[model samples]
Target: MWVFVAAVFALLYVPLFILAAFSLNDSIIVALPFRGFSFEWYSAALDDVDVREAVGNSLLVALAVVPLSVTVGTLAAFGLTRFRFRLKSAVAGLVGAPLVVSWLVMGVGALLLFSALSIPLSLKTIGAVHIMASFPLVTAIVSARLIRFDRSIEEAALDLGALPRTVLARIVLPQLIPSLVASALLVFAWSFNNFTLSFFTAGFETTFPIWVYSNVEHARALPIVNAVSTFVLGVQILLTFLVWYLLRLRPGGRSAAAPLLPGLATTERTDG
Candidate 1:
């Protein structure tokens, strides 16, 4: 079991280790041969104006996508979980269809829709597509937690003269903070790394992934892309640790945090 787990982790992270190593390679060509180490590519990536612009565009879209997708998804989750309607199951299926569908197919379909409506493609279109693609996951995450909630507590609160909106804002949403935070992180990463969907929907606005795609054809740009990717990976690692530490500080502590940072969380069983 340990060997299998080790192999799986190696498969997941070895490429990242190699990418980080190559980012320091002195040669522009991204191939093996143990080139002398240098940090020039990192500086080059920072100095490149196109790379900077693409980074800004990707960051802006991702930041925008997190809130929009989570808001839409959380609302959908509430509708599905808290309300009864004739089309509830059908609506749930429709919301979740994107999870099973191919991103390429969705992107192409979105392109056709935008073109038919004569809506010019831009970062807005990319963000719209990302929201459509990712909101279902948020719904799933929040719905699962909502289903497990103690309905009696909410009922008791309602009996105490709490407004419906107040219960939602002060009770339901507080309990679901971990789910919301996890969903936001996932949405941000998905939006930032997405290429195929963004490629189809983007007009003149270039994302970081798009910039890398366009520049990868040239040998000189490979190391720079590697450097940027390594930097991104480092940031993600730091953010993950930060989130875990903050979760540990929450009132419920690591037990509450286990939902999002399972690897860093611990649980104990007691019998009385």
Candidate 2:
């Protein structure tokens, strides 16, 4: 059993390790035992105008995607989890449909929708599609966290005369920080690395994934591609580490998931 697990992990990760290793190799062709280590490819990747522009565009779209997806997803999660509704089950199915649906189908559907609406494709369109693709994942994450939330704390806050929004802000949101941070990270990574949906919706705008795909067929670009991809992987790892450091284990050593509303969900009351 352990052997099978190890094999599965190796199948998933060994290629990534090799890719990272070759990105540092001082060889133009990505083969071989080893050339001396060099940062030449990394330098070249950073210096390329198209590569920089594509990366910049990807960052722009991902930045836009994170906030919007998180907001819409958090709201959707709250609605689904906190309310009694006629179509609650159906709504959940609709939200989760994107996760099960193939990117190709969604991409094609997005393209058709944009065309029917006569909306010209651009970076905004790309951002829109990314939000569409990513929010369900965000919703799923936040909903999972919310499901385990103790409602007594919330009811106490409300009974103490806290406004609904105040109960949400002070009583509910405080415990949801870790999940929100995780959802943001996932959304950013998803949008930045997206290709198929970006391809359908991007029109003339290029993102990092599109640039990498365009360059993939060229032998001359392989090492530089490796360098850029390695850099992206490092950034993702750093982001993950930073999030864990800041949220999972705080500087003061308290769990970020620890409830802030224990006895402090207080505000003055007014009778009307």
What TM-score, computed on C-alpha atoms, does each candidate reach?
0.88, 0.87
Candidate 2 stretches greater than 4 Å from native: 242-247, 250-272
* Reference-based lDDT, each prediction: 0.84, 0.83
* Candidate 1 lDDT over residue span 1-272, tens digit each: 99999999999999999999999998978887977999999999999998899999999999999999999999998899988999888998899788777888888999999999999999999999989888887887778778878889889999999998999889888988877886777677778888889999999989988998898788777888999989988987776666577666767787866764542221101110
Mind giving the per-residue lDDT tens digits that candidate 2 earns over 100-179? 77888889999999999999999999998888778887787778778878999989989999999999889788878877
Q: How accurate locally is residue 100 in candidate 1, as Cα lDDT from 0 to 100?
A: 75
- The window of 10 residues in a row where model 2 has the poorest summed lDDT is 263-272
For model 1, the superposed segments whose C-alpha errors exceed 4 Å read 241-272
Q: Which residue pairs come into collision in candidate 2?
A: none
Candidate achieving the largest lDDT? 1
Per-candidate alpha-carbon RMSD to the true structure: 6.2, 8.8
How big is the positional error of residue 144 in model 1, measured in Å on the Cα after superposition? 1.5
